[model samples]
Target: MRIRSLTARVLILATLWSALALVTIAVAISALYRQGVERGFNNLLRAQLYNVVNSVSIGDSDSLTGSPALGDLRFSQPATGWYWLVEPLGNYATAPLASASLGVANLAVPDVEATPFDQNYERYYEMTDDVANHIRVAETEVVLDDQGRAARFRVSGNLQVVEDEIAFFTSRLYAALAVVGIGGLIVNGLAILYGLKPLDRARRALERIRRGEAERIEGDFPSEVQPLANEINALIDSNRRIVERARMQVGNLAHSLKTPIAVLLNEARTLEKNQAEVIATQAEAMQAQVSSYLNRARIAAQRDSVLARTEAQPVMERLARVMRKLNADILFELDVAPDLTFAMEQQDVEEVVGNLLENASRFARTKVVTKAVMTARDDEPTDGRRGWIEVVVEDDGPGLAPDQIGEALKRGRRLDESKPGTGLGLSIVKEISGEYQGSFGLSRAGIGGLRAQLILPAVTKDTA
Candidate 1:
C-alpha cells in the first residue's frame, strides 16, 4: 500500500538515500584499504631485494656473489614461496646465488621488452610459482664493479596473504557501516515526527471546529502553518455571516409572502360561497408551500454553521411540560440525562421535538413518552466528536397500520381529516433531520402506539 502520511514518506526516503550513501562509502573505503595493503606488500618485497643487493660484491673472479639473509623463517624453508636470487645479466657467466627456499626451482622473470624497469632500475610483478602458490616479485639491477657488470636481484613473497587480509578488513567494514546506517535512519525518523508535530496540532484544532466544540481554529501553530489557520478562521467567519444573511432573507420573504396570502383569504370571504371556497383552499395551499420552502431555506443555512449546539435535556423537558399543559387528559413522561447535548441550534431542536410531542399528544389516549439518549451509528464518520443523540416520542393512541405509516409522513396527507393540522409536522421534522445529516423514522412502539425516532449529531458534555 502507498504511504499517505507525510512523516512516513520523508522517513522512508531518508532511509533509502542514507543506505545508498553508506554502501558507496563502504565500497570506496574498502578499495582504498586494499590499495594501501598491496603497496605495503610491494614495499616489503622491494626491501628484501635491496638486502640481497647489499650483500653481494664483485669477488676474485670479478663476478657477482653472496646470499641474502632476509631474516624470515620462510626464506630458509625449501619452496616456501619466499625467496631471493642474485644472477649476472648479459653473458656474465657467474653461478647464481639463491635462498634455500628456491630449492631446485627458479623464480620466473619477465622479459625487459615486455615489462620494462622504472627510472630507479626496479620492477614488480605477480605470478604463480612452480609449487602452485601465488607470489609477488620485486626485481632490481645493480652494478657491482667499475667495469660496468650488472646483476639482477629478485625477491618473492606470497600474494595470497595480502588478499586474505583485505577480505577480512572489508567484512568488518561492512558490519560497522550497517550499524551506523541503521542508527542514522532511526534518528532521521524521530526528527521528522518531531518536526511535523505542529501539523498534528493544527489537525486537532480543525476537528474541534467541525464538532461545534469551538467557534474557530485556535492554537499556536508554527510559522509555516499559521497562515493556513488564519485563512480557515476567516472563511468560517465569512460563512457565519452568510448564514445570518440567509436567515434574515428567509424571515423577510416569509413575512412578505404571508401577508399577501392572508389578504387574499380575507378578501375571498365576501364572495359567493363557491368562489370563496376555491379562493380559500388555494390560498391555504400557497401558505403551506411558502412556509415549507422557507423552513427548508432556514435549515439549509443553519445546518452548516459550526457554532450550533443545544442542550437536549432542557429542551425536551420544556417541551414535555408545555405538551402536558396543552393536553390535560394525556400524561407526559420524559426520560433524558441532564448532560445530554446535541450539535444543533436551540430553535431547530425546539421545532423538531415540539412537533413530535404535539402530534403524539393529539393522538395519545392516556400517555406519551419522550426519551433522549446518546448512541453510536455505523454510517457516520469516526471523527473525534461524540456520536449522536436519539430522541424518541411514542404515544399510546390507536396507531396507523404499516401501510398508512408511510403516507403520514407526506407533506399534506393527514390521515385523520377531523384532526386540526396542516399535515406538515412530521415532514418538517424529517427535513430538519436530513439537513443536519441525521435520521427520522416511524416504527411500532412498545406502548402499542405510534413511535417517532429522531437522530441528530451530539456533543460531548465537556464541549457542550
Candidate 2:
C-alpha cells in the first residue's frame, strides 16, 4: 500500500468546497421537501373547510343539533389531520383542539389587491403554539365553494403533526449529511491517495536517487507527474556528471601545477637575501593567480553545463543550508515562489547564487537575503514577451558607490584588490544575465546596504 502526500493547503481547499457543495444540496432538498408537504397540507385543509361551511345554516330552534344536508359531514370528530370552523358571528365556531394555538379565531379576511376573491380560501398562514411549534390554516366563506351556497367555515390545525413530519425529514437530512460527510471524507482521502499513487512510486525512486541506487527519476508513474519526475531525474544526472567531471579536471590541473610550484620554491632558495625575498614574493603571487583562475574556471564550468529546467527555491534552500553549515551565525532568508520554475539548469542557478551569496555572507554583519520572484514589466502584457524575473541578493553592509559598482565586475577589478578576492563573482553574474537575455543592476538596498537585482527574461520555451 502506498500513501500519497497531499499539500495541506490544497487539501483544506478541496474539503471546504466539497462540504459547501454537499451542504447546499442538503439545504435545497429540505427546502423542496418542506414546500411540497406544506402545499399538500394546505390543500387538504381547504377541502375540509369547504365541506363544513356548506353544511351550516341559521336554525329556528337555535339548538344547533342538526348537521347541514347540502354538504357531507361524515363524522363529527374525524381521525384525519383536518379541522373546520363555522362562525355565524365573530367568535362563534367549533374547531379541533389543535387549532387553539394556531389562533384559528384570529385569522383576518384576505385583503383585495394582494389576495384575490378566488384565492382567499386557498391562502394558508402559519402560527406558533404554546410550546412554540408551527400550524397552518385555510379559512373562507362557503358561498364561493363547489357545493351549493352555504354559510362560512374557517379551517385550522396545529402543524405539529406537520412539524413532527418536518422533524422526521430534518433528521433524515442530517443523517444523510453525516453519511455523505463521513463517506465523502473517506472517498476524498481514497481519491487523493489513488491520484497520488504515481507520486509515491516516484518518491521511492527519488529516494533511490538520493542513495545513489538509481541514476534517474524513472518509475511507473502516471502520465500527469511522470514528466516532472523524469525532468528532475534528468537534471540530477546531468548535474552529477558536470560536478564529477569538473572535480576530476581540477584534480588534474592541480597535479600539473605542483611541479612548477615546487620548481619556483627551489629556485627562490638559490638567490641572495633581497633577491630571494623578491623571488619568493613573485612565486607566491603566481601560485595565488593560478589558484584564482582555477576557482573561476570551476564556477563558470558549472554555470555553462547545467542544461535542464530547474526549480530555484529547492536549489537555493539547499545552497543556503550548505552556506549556514559552513558559517553558523548567519540568518538566511529566501522569498521565492515554490512552483515557479525556469529553463536554467540547477548548477547554473547554483553558480549564480553560490558566488554572490558566498560573497554576501563574507561581507554581511548579520543577515543575508536571497529572493526570486516572478514579475512582469508594467508595460508588458502577461502572455506577451515582456514578463521578467527579479532576483535580489542583499546584505546589510557598507554600500558600494555607483561609479565603483560597474568597474568592480571586470575579471580582476576588485575594489580593494588587497582583500584576496578574484573579482569573478559579479562579473559572472553580469555575463550570465546577458547570456539569459536579462538585465542586471547593482544599487543601494532599501536597508541602506548593497543590493544586486537581476531581472531575467521570462521562461520563453514551450512549457505547455
Candidate 3:
C-alpha cells in the first residue's frame, strides 16, 4: 500500500536514497581495495624475482647455478604456484635454473606485443599454470656478467590467493556499510517525526475549534506553520462575519415585511364580507411563507457558528414543564442526561424541540414521551464533531402510515384538516436539522403513536 502520511513518505525516501548511496560507496571501495591488494601482490612477486636474479651467477663451465632461498615454504613445494626461474638470453647455451616448485614445467613468457615491459625493464602478468592454478608472474632482464650476457628472471605467485583476500574484504565492507545505512535511516525517521510535531498540534487545535470546544486555534507553532494557523483563524472570523451579516439582513427583511403584512390584514377587515375572507386567507398564507423562510435563514446562519452550544437536559426539562402546564390532560415524560449537550445554539434547540413537543402534545391522547441522549455516530463527520445528540418525542395518539409520514413533513402539509395548525411544524424541524447537518425521521413508536427523531451534532467533553 502507498503511504499517506508525510512522515512515512519522508522516511521511505530517505531509506531508498541511503541504500543507493551506500551501495555505490561499497562498490567503489571494493574496487579500490582490489587494486591495492593486486599492487602489493605484484610487489611481493617482484621482490622474489630480484632475489632469484642475485642468487644465480656464471660458474666455471659458464652455466647459471645457485640455490635461491626466498624464505617462503611454498617455494620449496612442487607445483605450489610459487616459483622462480633464471635462464640465459640470446642463445648463450647456459642451462636454466628453477625453483623446486617448478617441477620441470616452465613459466611461459608473455608476448612483448601483448604485455610490454615498463620503463624499468620489468613485465608483470597473470596466467594459469600446468595444474590449472591461477598465478601472477613478474619478469625482468638483467646482465649477469661483464661479457653482456643477459638472463631473464621471473617469479610466480598464486593469483587466486589475492582474489580470495579481496572477496573477504569486500564482504566485510558491505556488512559495515549496511549497518551504517540502517542507522542513518533510523535517525532520519526520528528527526522527521520530531520536526513535524508542530503540524500535528495545529491539526488538533483546528479539531477543537470544529468541535465547538474552542473558538480558534490555540498554542504556539513553528514559524513555518504559524502563517497557516493565522490564515485559518482569519477564515473562521470572516465566516462568522458573513453569517452574522446574513442573519441581520434576514431579521431586517422579516421586520420590514411584518408591518406591511399586518396593514394588509387590517385593510382586509374593512372590505366586503366575501372580499375580506379572500384577502385574509391570502394574507395569512403570505405571513406563513415569510415566517417559514425567515426561520430557515436564521437557522442557516447559526448552524455554522463554532460557539453555539446548548445543554439538552435543561432545554428538555424546561420544555417538558411548559408542555405539562399547557396540556394538563396529558402526562409528559422527560428522559435526558444533564451532561448531554449539543453543538447548537440554545434558541435553535428550543425551536426544534419546542416544535416537536408541541406537535406531540396536540396529537397525544394522554401521554407524551421525550428522550435525549448522546449517541456515537456510525460515520465520521467532516467538521470533527465526534458524536450526535438524538432527541425523540413520541405521542400515544393516532399515527400516520409509512406513505403519510413523508407527506406530513412537507411544508404547509397538514394530514388532518381538523387540527388547528399551519402545518409548518415538522417541515421546519426537518429544515433546521438539515441546516445543522443533522437528520430528522418519523417512525412508529412502541406506544403505537407517531415518533419523531432529531439527531444533531453533540459537544464532546474536553479531556485535555
Candidate 4:
C-alpha cells in the first residue's frame, strides 16, 4: 500500500494507539509487581531485626551481643549478602556484632538521631557494598532489658533478589506486549481491507460506466458511500437527457433552414436568363452550405453519446452488397474480421463506411478494396478506449499529390470539375471521424491509388 493512501493512514494511526495502550498496561503491571516485591522483602527484614533485638540483653560488660538470623542459610555464609548487626548507641559501653556473611565488611548504619522512626519504631534505608550488590537495611533503636542503656539493631538483605525479579518480569512483559501489538496490527489491517471492499466495487462500477458497458452505477454500497453513487447515476441520466434534447432541437433547426433554400432554388428558374443563372448558383451554394453545416452539427451531437455497438462484418457486408449494385462495372473486394464491432451508432458507421467505399468505387479504374480490422491505437488512452476499428478503402484509379489530397478534404473542393458529384464526401468523413475522437487520413495504397483510413472506437462482446 502507498504510504499516503487511506488504508495506510488508518493502519498507522491504529498501530500507534495500540502500541501506546499496550505500553501503558505493561508499565502499570510492572509497577504493581515491584511494589509487592518491596513490601514482602521489607517484612522479612523487619522479622530479622526483631529477632536480633530480642536476642540481646544487658550483658555482664554492658555490650550488645546477639545470635540472630532470618532462618536463611545465606546468613551463615561469608559475603553471601545477608546479615544482621546490633551496636550500642550514643557511646554506650558496648561494641557492634554482626552475622558471619558480613565478613570483614562494615555494615554502615543510618544515623538514628537524624532519621525519624516509622509507626513500628523501625526505619529503613538502602546501601551498596564494595561488591556492587545493592543491600536493603532495616534499623531500629531499642533499650535492652529494663535498663536505660539503648542499642541500635539492623537487618541487611541483598536488594539483588528484588532487582533480578523485576528485570526478568520486565523482559517477559515487553515480549508479551510486542506479540500483542503485532497481533492487533494484523487484525486492524484485515478489518480495514474488508471494510473498504465496497469502495473498490464502486470504483470498478465507475470504470464500467465510463466504458459504456453500464449506463449508470449499480451495486450495494456502504451507507456512507451510497449517496455518492446515487448522485453519479443522477448526473449520467441528466447528461443523456440534455444531449437528446439538443439533438432534437438541432434536427428541427436543420429542417427549418433547408425548406427555405429549396424554395429559393425552385423560384429562381422563373426569372430572366442572366439573373436566373446568378440566383440559381447562389441558391444551390446556400443549400449545400446548409446541408453541410447541419450534418456536422448532428455528428458533433452524437459523437460522444453512449451508443450501441454495431457489428463491423455485417456493416461492411451490407455496404459491399449495395456498392456492387451501384458500381456494377467495377470489381469490389471486402476483407473484414468476424465478430469485430464498432462502439458507435449503426447509422453513423454506415455513413462513414458508405462514403469511403462509394468514393473509392467512383474513382477506381478496375478494382476497389474495402478492409476492416480491429487494432490497438496508441493515440487513445489504455482505459477501455485503446481498442479501435480501422477501415481502409483503396482503389486502382489515379491518385492526387499529398498537397492536393489535404485540400481535397475541404468542403466542396472538387479537384476535377468533370466529376459528376459535389466533393463533400471526404470532408464529411474527416469531420465526423474527428467528432468521435477518431482519426481520418489519406495515404498511398499498395494498389497504386489513394488510400482512405478511418479509425473509430471498437467494442467487443466482453467489454460491451
C-alpha local distance difference test of each model: 0.86, 0.65, 0.87, 0.82
Q: Please give the RMSD to the true structure for each candidate, in Å.
A: 3.9, 15.1, 3.6, 4.1
Top lDDT model: 3
In model 1, which residue pairs have backbone atoms overlapping below 3 Å? none
- Give the TM-score of each candidate: 0.84, 0.47, 0.86, 0.81
- The lDDT, on a scale of 0 to 1, for candidate 4 is 0.82
Q: For model 3, which pairs clash?
A: none
Report the Cα lDDT for residue 62, model 4.
65
Tens digits of per-residue lDDT for model 1, 65-88: 676677899998887789888888
Q: Which segments of model 4 are wrong by more than 4 Å?
A: 1-4, 24-48, 51-65, 93-95, 110-124, 211-213, 261-288, 298-317, 328-346, 370-390, 455-464
Q: Candidate 3 overall Cα lDDT vs. reference? A: 0.87
lDDT at position 362, candidate 2: 71
lDDT of 3 by residue, 373-408 (tens): 877666545545456888999999998899999999
When 2 and 4 are scored with TM-score, the better candidate is: 4
Better of 1 and 3 by TM-score: 3
Span of ten consecutive residues with least summed lDDT in model 2: 94-103
